[model samples]
Target: MAGRIAAVSIVEAIAADLRNRIFTGDLVSGQTLTETDVASTYEVARPTAKASIEKLVAEGLLDRGTHKTARVIELGPESVRDIYLARAYLESEVLRRLARDKAVPGDAVLANSEIAALQSGAPLDVVEPDMRFHLSLIDAVGNERISRMYRSLVGEVRMCMVRVQSLHLLDNALIHNEHQRILELIESGQGDAAAQLLDEHLGRARERLVAAMGGTAGPEAALPSTLD
Candidate 1:
């Protein structure tokens, strides 16, 4: 039991290191990872490296198949459009419900902190704070079904964010202010308005992502949110 626990710890550490690389763009999308390479690089046993890869695979950070090494997720424009549409629908409802109930998010401070970090250009995981903010919204609702569904979709969301950042589609100020608007609307108890703004905010991002990928804009990406 002790040996298994120790091995798990090692796997977590290695996986964290790799995960950070992926988050910060050191490891680009579609990069391949192999147990042998990880083991040699980290000076750990092959089994340990394999365990780490499996962990990342479960997190949706890596995709492993029967005969191929795991690769970082590479999403196309259509996928981005689909995922953000789902997020916009689900997360806006979370805000609307909370707004209607007059309930404050316990993690609101942390979510605001992320926006501040983006505004200040603080050194961060680059995409982690954004993920945390969205996930917090779903988790705070205390619904297992919604939380599980959101969690499962986070990996793809992360990919979309990476592309957004890399393309500089929306500047820090845009992202920060949009988040602030969402919070303000929720605080003012305007549930439907908040939901609409949230939809438009995500829709702008979706359109930018699709355009960056050389794809056509879908109906859901038709919001006119200004990025400048």
Candidate 2:
């Protein structure tokens, strides 16, 4: 039993390493990962390397080709659109509920702190405060299920932020202003208006990114069941 647990831990470590490489663009889209390379690089057995590859595949960080080789999955336009659209749709609800039922003072205090930090010259790449600001809004709804759903999207969301930053396309001031505006609307009990602003904010970001990436998938397809 201890051996099995130890093996799982090793595989998880390998997966974590490869995952970082993928998200950081060290191992880019469609790059193949052979089991031999994994074993030699990580000094693990073949089975361990294979397990690591499978773990990454499950996380959508890699894909298996017809020849059964693991390759990094490309973040296509469709995927990007789906990520942002769903986020906007669901997050608008968080803001909407915040307008109707959520307490304003606590969330406003937290959001204002983030805005102040941005005003004080904090870099946008430092996403901790940014994440906290947005997450606090979602969390204010007091729905564990909705919050849990947003948690699942964090990885992709961060991926987009990092990629945009790398491409020199991220607008720090724009994002800050938009977030400040949304928070203001929410605290003012303008739920519908806040939701509209949130939708436009996410929509424009998605359109800008997908257009830059050459996606023609009509911006977004059907939403996942989580949206419903």
Top model number, lDDT:
1
Give the local distance difference test score of model 1.
Answer: 0.79
Residue range 178-201, candidate 2, lDDT tens digits = 777777787788999888877766
Model 2 steric clash pairs: none
State how far residue 183 of model 2 sits from its true place (Å). Answer: 2.1
Number of residue pairs clashing in candidate 1, backbone atoms closer than 3 angstroms, sequence gap of 3 or more or interchain: 0
The alpha-carbon deviation from the true structure for residue 118 of candidate 1, after best TM-score superposition, in angstroms, is: 4.4
For candidate 1, lDDT tens digit of each residue in 1-228?
A: 999899889999999899878877788889999999999999999999999999889988899889889999777787787898888888988998878876667586476576666544423444667677677777878999999988877867877887787777766666667777777777788888888888878888888789888898766455545333
Clashing pairs in 1: none
- TM-scores of all candidate predictions against the true structure: 0.86, 0.74
Model 2 residue 177 CA deviation in Å: 2.1
